[model samples]
Target: MVEVADTAVRAGLSGPRHPADPARRREARAGYGLMSPALLLMVAVLALPLAALIVLSFWTQSGFTLDRTFTLANYWRLIAPSDREVEWMGLTFRLAYPVPAILIIKSLVMSLTATVAVILLAYPMAYFLAFRVHRNKAAWIILLTVPFWTSYLLRVFSWKVVLGYNGAINSGLMSLGIIDAPLEFLLYNPAAVTITLAHSWVSFIVLPIYVSLEKIDRSMLEAASDLGDSKWKRFRRITLPLSMPGTISAALLVFIPTVGDYVTPELVGGPGGTMIGSLVQQLFTKQNNAPLGAAVSLVMMLIIGAMVLIFLTLIGYWRMRARRAA
Candidate 1:
């Protein structure tokens, strides 16, 4: 009799037409139904425009009107280097780089320089906040984020003032009898853009690193300490490895977006600091070449994506090696 009861209970629990599956299926259906609206909105807002851009990237334009006919001319021009005569200030100059190539190379170099600067400056601040500050942490975070509360354009313009000729630095140095004239090099150059981007994105880099460092288990550090590990060794083997996810994440966050950043480069970056984003804007708007602009945009996205992939691969290999050694 006991065996029969056990058999019945097991059948009820595990067999088809079971008691709980209907309720679970209903819950899942409801969940999917709730998410459908958000999914639809995403398709309408993002997917539709992206599809249009992709389609337009393959189309051709003639005399301010698109043909809507499939062609690879836009992409071919971007891929093949072409010579162009640039008449700047009534002087004819030969440029080896097509606009697309010029923008791509310039943006890549500028963004990389800014990324390295931001990461170098942000890491120490994040480390100190995570491990050194023992009180009022929220206040520090708020203070750090204070820059973001202001408008982005306002912040970029502020950098222009600080770096301009007769701006704060130049005037201050002049007042101190350090220099006879204002520093012309401080504004309207790649250096100015690099500095402004680093300052503008510091908070973004810091927060990810801070969150990653904060997630580290203190007991692991204590255990390493107990195992005859020096402070430096403990940090190298424990602290850095655990916090790398956040560090890499912060890098991606800054590196990817800044690749196409035109605002900071536009305001402080004179002719010397012109970036790809600005070029794309001109291509799309002033030139009325949306197809070419789309092509350039896709090219930039691909390059940035490739960079991210390479970074992730390196990080994965490092983690694998560390795990194997341990």
Candidate 2:
């Protein structure tokens, strides 16, 4: 009896296997295996390059060759009080202790101006497309995106011709007797750079805002109207506030790129149009100073990062407040 009981107990102790556990384990393995390729690609494409840049930014270089030694000289040089002008590739460069400061301010101003202009221009256009022009919405959206098919370089260069001294505006003004001489202010200035960048990136700002605005429920607006809200009041209290997310997102998209743009400044910005990006390019290509260039790039990255963080924080705070109020 005892021997039989022991055998039975042992058999009972060997519990039934869980089919779900093995199935779950297999599924998890398959999911990870599928994702591994994409994960590796991301690491190779983005992570590795970013890590290399960070490392290179700290390394000293001589005549395009990097030194293995680590040094703080690159960062220190940013604020080095030197009256001696650094000349590279026949262009004389002076270190203004305040150059970085000025660059940040200028970049922000230009970006803000461009963002505001895009929002103002895009809002009405987007609204018209979303609410009023529903018959051919897809066609209109395609038309809006058609500019992207053209080469960005060509489009920007075309502006040079349009805004040149002997260009379209000058000819038109002359034909109409609006001016006796060609206006020099038409191109190669900060204003020209701002205008060109705004035109180039207008679509980026418009598309996102349009999508967001289009998603807004018309019933909400109708409810506001039914609740005795005036047209202006409805827009102010409802339409504008609800559209804040799109506006904020558009501002971010425009501001981030415009702040780092070198091409616009080089092409349209004549004398006083040099930004931090131009400085970085000079360091890398002209001066053959990779460390210094890296430092500048890192600084620019930090500035943009800070701006993004602040914008996100503000958005979060506003969202929380809005939710609480609701």
> What's the lDDT of the predicted structure labeled candidate 2?
0.80
Residue-wise C-alpha lDDT for candidate 2, range 167-276, written one tens digit per residue: 99998998899999999988987788888888998876678778877888899899999999998899898888777777777777788888889888888788776777
Clashing pairs in 2: none
> What TM value does model 1 have?
0.86
TM-scores, one per candidate:
0.86, 0.82
Model 1 per-residue lDDT at 91: 49
Prediction-by-prediction clash tally:
0, 0
